[model samples]
Target: MFESPNELNIARKEHKHLSFSAGIYYCLGGQAAKLEIEVAFNCLCDKFKQPRLQEEPVWRKNSNMHGMEMLMIAI
Candidate 1:
């Protein structure tokens, strides 16, 4: 489980993620955020012929935040 949170394993049958909070504390912009991501990915797919990673992603060092610090991609 130590390594599980470091990667995007979409194929996992079950998982737990709390990025947008939950219940009464749920993020109001969660849906909007999802929509924005979807639109951005769609646009990238339409605009780029074959975009690929230019280098390995650098992940953030913050224990409180789990995300990439730099993700270079080549179009």
Candidate 2:
């Protein structure tokens, strides 16, 4: 969702490490993985009163990955 190069660049720099798995060929199951995660999260959220974060997570951006590296959530 970052619209500018500066924003994207800053997010990418917040992390100390990076990895990329798009090697010889692209992942054939990427969509399946995404769908699976979404379904699981939706079910959990529906059953919870309030999803609370344990702490603010580091936002890391790198090639093919952009998400919380460590997170704890409770209802």
Candidate 3:
């Protein structure tokens, strides 16, 4: 569904699918999760002067989910 997976656009609104699924399969905790992530990321950015990846990230093994299991970052 994503034409350019490498691109990052936090303000984009033309998504075909929600991160937490859609309709009857939608997650109730999606909003809370998103808020938590935003807070955490903001905290990290504020605290770290120069944050960077220390090593290659380890991807999760789920076919339906795309995420990292292990990501080592240096600040």
Clashes of each: 0, 0, 0
What are the clashing pairs of model 2?
none
Q: Which stretches of candidate 3 lie over 4 Å from their true place?
A: 4-14
User: Can you write out model 1's per-residue Cα lDDT over 1-75, one digit (the tens) per residue?
Assistant: 435666544355553457788889988999999799879878887999987778877899987977889978799
lDDT of 2 by residue, 32-75 (tens): 87588779878877989777676665566764666656666767
lDDT over C-alpha atoms for residue 22 of model 3: 97
| Candidates 1 and 3 compared by lDDT, better number | 3
Q: What is the lDDT of candidate 2?
A: 0.58
Better of 1 and 3 by TM-score: 1
Query: How does each model score on lDDT?
Result: 0.76, 0.58, 0.77
Show where candidate 1 strays beyond 4 Å.
1-3, 8-15
Residue 4 of model 1 has an lDDT of 60
Clashing pairs in 3: none
- Lowest-sum lDDT 10-residue window in model 3: 3-12
Q: Which regions of candidate 2 are displaced past 4 Å? A: 1-24, 58-69
